[model samples]
Target: MVAETTLRPADLIAPLFVREGVTSPVPISSLPGVSQLDLASLRSEVAQLVSVGVRSVILFGIPLKKDPIGSGASDPDGIVQVAIRELRQCFGEEIVILADLCLDEYTDHGHCGVLTPTGEVHNDDTLVRYQEVALAQAAAGVDLVAPSGMMDGQVGA
Candidate 1:
């Protein structure tokens, strides 16, 4: 009790990994108890978290279809966007929903940014992609967008 630290359920932000086109939640052996959730499992897990007083969550999406431009990152019907809308409709403002804005998971090559003809990361081009992804997340009722791509000017842009 001597520690000057205060923690509550609100302070805990659950990180969810959601996979597109999955019929069931997939276990992530590397993450111990964590699993990549399908839409149904995601809803059930979030409900359980809310029942236990957790009021915040951030989502990462794994698209079944990855492209060079990571087009799914900004698609209104993308996995993350759909998940965000579903959560918002189910929980409304009772919980804070955040989206992890990045293209790595949606890119076939697993790079965080768009590539040049020489196969190098194109910074400026990737910024535009980030903007599109951010806008898409906003339109999906996300309370916050966490740009985890480690790109320069990501927050400022």
Candidate 2:
């Protein structure tokens, strides 16, 4: 008899990237065999993942727009929000949906936090944006939010 491990398809989490503005999937050269998908393509990908016994997915959105404050990260109508809603509607809670809670993908400067006049990251100011992003992801029906920016007290904030 084969021993069964605790790990199962239910424990699998697929990571997905949603790129804003593009209507089709765009190749990500840095990550071979990966593409930044649009809404429609994302749906198709999710369907495929689920079909293959993957029960969950974590989303990272590449907004069509970015700003110093990472406004797109907190926008209710942003790419992640839209993707969350669509996934929920399609899977109807059968599939676990997660959102990446961070500022790097949404910040035009590519830093995880807001920068000061000295070009240094402002920690406290960035906490506010992280909080806002958490709330936004929750409101968008994300089952889980994972903050990857390594900011201090990000989970608490």
Which candidate leads the pack in TM-score?
1
Which one wins on lDDT? Answer: 1
lDDT by residue for model 1 (90-109), tens:
99999999999889999989
Each candidate: how many clashes? 0, 0
For all candidates in order, the CA lDDT equals 0.95, 0.91
Clashing pairs in 1: none
In candidate 2, which residue pairs get closer than 3 Å at backbone N, Cα or C atoms, i.e. clash? none
Given candidate 1, what's the lDDT at residue 119?
96
Q: Which stretches of candidate 2 lie over 4 Å from their true place?
A: 1-6
Those runs of model 1 whose alpha carbons end farther than 4 Å from true positions after fitting are 1-3
For candidate 1, the C-alpha RMSD (Å) to the true structure equals 1.4
